[model samples]
Target: MNHAHSWVHAFQDRLDLAPFGSAGLALFALALKFGYDDVASIGIDAVVDGPDDRSVDLVYVDRDQRLAVVAQSYVANTPKGQAKASKAATLRQALSYLIEVDLESLPERLWPAASDLRSALAEGAIDQLYVWFVHNCPSSRNVSNEIRTVGATVTSMIRAHFENSNIDIFADDISSEVLEQLYTDTNTPILVNDKISFITHTTLSFEEKEWQCVIAPIKLSDLKSLYTSHETRLFSANVRDFLGMKAGDSNINHQMQKTISENPQNFFIYNNGITLLTHGVDVFDVPNGKRIDAHGLSIVNGAQTTGTVGTSEIEPPADAFVLARFISTKSGDLIGDVVRYNNRQNAVTASDFRSTDSIQKQLVDQMKRIPNAEYDGGRRGGVSAAIKRRPNLLPSYSVGQALAAVHGDPTVAYNEKSAIWSKDALYSRYFNEQLTARHVVFCYGLLKAVENEKNELRKREHNHEKLTKADIAKLEFYRKRGAVLLLCAAIGECLETIADRVIANRFSLTFGEKDSPEDAAAYWQPTVKAISGLHAHLEKAFSDGLKNQEKVRETLKNFSQIVATLRAPFAEFFKSVENKLS
Candidate 1:
């Protein structure tokens, strides 16, 4: 099958298994296209029946983008007149619903997604509300314009409700053609150059390995063209993203630009050369200088330099120079090593190198063995394997969070951005020997179960439809701070209880030791059963906490208090397990 067809088939399989059918699949496809690491369907219903979906079919909050996407799917196998009308009506209703609903009064189940929207709005992180009208059938220009009009109306309403928050509304009709394009995997071939001339050349040796380096002076205009043509994809293989230079700042970029404009001759000496990785390079004699034709040229370092040079306001001198290091290697593993070495030289964060660690490799292999578990270790191979094998599984970052949770620090896992992968204290905690593949899977299961329950609750709320004012008020209470963190803390408390029991019994099946992986695999069934039992109790605790509703929001806001609240109940539940073991 072609790439598009294969992706469609995979999505179909997921839809068959998923509770929120077409709408959920559309959301997932969109999430993948936008490079979101994790997404859960917050749709209200499985099927897009008539009206009454309350206009929003699915919602996804992306923290990285500080964006919340609310989508309404209109899938019609046969685009008859009635079907088209229904689709159009649904789209209009979705837009109206978004405008009319008070975010603070949303049902409790939606609070997870809504809380993100609220946070972004309050922080001014998000300025646009994207409402996608996803349709299986084709749409015309007239329909698109109508949708845009509705979007403008919603934008005005949102501004009014949000205290002139200046939130824009973008409405687009994603037709079948667009969906196919989104799913299609396109691999663009990189241009190959055999020999490229450099004004100056040098050699660097690291650990007995020699690297060929050269300084190349190219027109600043040509560099801008390359950047515009390739965009961010040019830096995909690099460890760090391009940090743009500020006008008033006296950073390295500013100094380099200054030298380029003032004395072009000194540009080569003042600037650190861009480090590049190529599959191979060939040398050829030319008139003024030699030609270096490189294959698969990627910038491994000097992103800031490139960004600064490309975006500089003043015209660069014709003779401005950029240092280039050409490393010729076709091996993917070697490319990663070269990138890591260059990034380390530049003082990049430890998180960038976590994927290369021995323990991470072992964990990736173990996760692959788990049924339905997909682990992308941020490598090209791992990412390809995940796309081909298990497209529905959460991304590597989510798996990292699970690792953090099981390793006994859900607080950091819940909050800190990118710290969980650090090689110092945080990384040590995550890869602690006590953590087994099974523990990771168990945590994964708990998260999935909780997400599933949240979806089901949304469905129930939608079906009931007649929520009283008091009912809405009570739910609003549960929607306050620390609600999701409370869930994480409860899981942590349960695991702590399990650890205490195992230590007291001095059982052969211990966790977090050197042999924990083997022990976890050996005792997989019992461990899963114990986790399942604990999960049931934890779910009850959550439900009870929601029902009590009195000061629960305040209690949940404090991490320690949330854990303390759950500790006794989890300890009591573990007592039965200990007795059974006896």
Candidate 2:
């Protein structure tokens, strides 16, 4: 199947959104642009559309990424040359209501998200603001022109309302073609198919195995042009995309921009330079420097440097040069390895560094014994580790999160993941000698069960299935940010009732050796249903924050008391599946 057909086929299973094709397009685009897990972190609040929703269909805010996405969506009932311009005009109205209106004037339903966007901007925390009109139809001159106006209009609004902010704004029509390209990008690396030839100072070539390498000094101006021409499409081989640079003295990307603006002459020596993966390269002598034409090129590393240079408001010095390392390979496995081992741009890479820990090794061995299980243990690497999905393939960071949320400190799992991997205190707290594959599966499965329940609720809404008032109430509570993680924490506190024993260390609890996370999730479904009915007790905890430890502890305590009275419902299920270590 092609991209659009594939989206139709899998949207229901993976995204839990295929019924309301038009309304769901914004989220579909958001998921395609960013990962779906990140969207879950933001919650169902991100998809706000109904009466008083105004023109905006989606509002996504990630302070950690220093980014926010506000989108309007449409899927034409009759396939047209393009979507109506009126829908595009709605983006302008959405921007005004979100930025210019007073907090009190907006509807109660839209207030929380509108406040989040404005607050993130005011604190100067957000650097990238993406305004998209996502649709299934093709792009047109009129809609494209309207999108351009939307960008210009939002820029003026920010200048007037947030004068201190230097927000980088991008406006685009996320049509089917764009979505198809984004889908294709996940697998196909070389999107910038333009033949690239540039002046080089002293070129060097070498060969090892099935790969060849070419090293040279490439002009920063030339790189800037390459980036200007292709934009983000230049880095399509990288599945993560750019995390968007922040503006501050402490920010590394900002520091890179500072270096280029202040001392361009030393950019070559100061920066780590760019690494290019290519199909072939041709070298020829030029007047002063050698010229090389590189074909099928994508940057495996140093995207930040190229992006810094490309986004510079100032022209780089004429003599400025950065070293470029080009690798040409015929072997596909080597190509994947090249992208895996070399590419490095993430907010959390410390977890991958913990791949060698003894606990992680033991877990890996233990996971192998469990059928249909693959646990990376913080050593998650490359495309295969990223895009592939299965019944119980648990990524390392998620395992860290589940363990943290179930044990204690739900906030650390939800908000402070970097600390979970980096700080020795947090690292040792979750992945210690007591940690095992079975424990990881038990905790991680509980978190997955909560997420699955939330998705099922969303699927019900999308399918227009009639829901009970209690189910509606539960859905509303689950829609809040960090609710799923907090509930995971809450449910962990009530495990004594399910286990029918006084559990000392929750980390020591285990499911059967043959059980995958899926099996554990199945065993815990009764518990999830039991907790799902008690939304009223859990709703009070979010008065503070979903990830707040104090609120989480209070909520967990209250729920434990309430669930102790309801123990009979879940005891039988846990009793049959509980695999206490021998």
Candidate 3:
């Protein structure tokens, strides 16, 4: 369908509106999303004549309290619509149904109970006016001019019809910057040009007598309701309640977690290009089952908060090894509790968790016996058995080292590494797995979150000094998906960053399993392709944000390029390593 068709689709869904009224509503909705507000339509004979045959799509009510009808010209075909499946048709079709109203009587008609409502609501001044047009199968060359002319015609009618309103009219979707550029670039005398550009130009006469027109006057609120309802029904229901659910709906998050947990094997795995150095971790969950990890870590969706826990609150599962040893535990889900604990740790301690050495010696000894404990390679690399005996000593040692480093205590500074590596290996393992998955989901969610963030940032910059909790909540939302894409993209970028000479050196580092260059490069191929697929998926999802989106979009545009840029080099790198191994 054309733009006119899709726009009308939004309006036609409302069973209560008259056909002309529905068209008017659609135009108003388009005007709202596109930044036009307070619209009024003008024309008595046209209203009586019926909007079924009118060429205009929407009408605008100026801040000055004048009414102007508008007509829009939008193209339909593969590239703009079918090629990418955009909303151009719906927007165009909706724009074609312009409504006409009387400026002198518009205040009374629009707000029947009060004529001052328009001015009172607008707070006395208006900024822009709009006119929409409807045309059928007009040639490409004539569409632009036709739109301008139709808008002009409605402007003239509105001016002659009202006589003294200071209202100015403009075409739909023309931003102030774009309009300024258009006017400045046009060939006309400075004085006349300034006065007769997009803001000032009005049609003295209509040239396209062949096209049909429909015009109606409708309330902006009704339009907003209709369009949003239409969009919710057609595209995304979540967008319908964006403001209400931005911090996120607990129900939605639960549902998402349920879906993921219910289908773990089927869920696509996304790694952060990092993994446990050793394997074999086992854990049991009643009513569910047992899980095994070759890399000593299993990734599961992290627990979601029920929101009952405060930032200061901390709780531990009775059977758990670490938190269980501390204070009395609380009942309820552990996810929110864990998040709170982490948050508090970061806030008060500036670290997420206590060092393993902080645990009592008896408890530390018991924890060490538990098989498949998560390990930190950086800290546990080569600790002596004697040092391992002192469980609570590590935290003090680590903290002391940090202080001593600043205070010039050589012994404290020398042993800082042990403090960092004192946590349970199994715990770190689970965290890595969960975080890898969360990060990927977060990246994907970021594309959708961009506009919301933009609005939030604007509000913060103008109205609030600090960002709201809701805005920060978006951080968790992004972490849930964004990390996956970031990891995959990181791998791709890494491969590209290494020059030809360093490529051989990189392949050695890339392979954890083999020293053979050939085998290493061959193993890298599938990994590269997997990362590339991730890039492709994200690029498509974020196509609207051209700059950030374009990075991956261009990278994945060609299948051959993906293979050449990412696949072949890895293959050669592996082959070279394999020869060395042989």
TM-score to true structure, per model: 0.61, 0.82, 0.19
Model 3 Cα lDDT, one tens digit per residue, 1-582: 334333334323433223233243433343323312111111110111112322333333322222333333332232132211122233333332222343343221222111221332234233235443332222233344544554566455545544543444554433222223222222111111111101111112112332211111112222223233332221110101111111233444333334333432222231111111111222223333222222211111111211111010223122211000001112222222222243231211212244333332323343243332222211221111111222112232222222222121222122122332334552332223222211211121221123223333333533536755654433222222122233233343344332223344221222222122222334344343334333333334233212244454344334324445654546554343233321
Give the per-residue lDDT of model 2 (tens digit) for 1-582. 133444544334544344334556676666566544333334445776555679877887766556789988877665456788888989898999899999789865576668778877998977789999988787788999999999999999999999899878999998777877765665576777777998877899998889899999998889889889888777876644554578788677788788788888998898887889887988899898788889978987878788888888877877899999988898876776677567434544557667778888899999999878887766654542343333356867678888898896777876676668878999999889988888888897888788778767767876778999988888777766667787888878877776777888887788888887787787777678667778788777666445467877887898888888877765654554343322
Give candidate 2's TM-score: 0.82
What's model 1's TM-score? 0.61
lDDT for 244 in candidate 3 is 15
lDDT for 122 (candidate 3): 38
lDDT of each: 0.50, 0.75, 0.27
RMSD of 1: 8.2
Error of 2 at 384 (Å): 7.8
Q: Comparing 1 and 2 by TM-score, which wins?
A: 2
Output the number of the TM-score-best candidate: 2
| Ranked by TM-score, top first | 2, 1, 3
> Which ranges of candidate 1 are over 4 A from the true structure?
1-6, 13-17, 34-54, 57-102, 105-112, 124-217, 227-280, 294-316, 323-329, 332-352, 361-386, 391-396, 403-411, 455-485, 491-582
lDDT of 2 at 169: 92
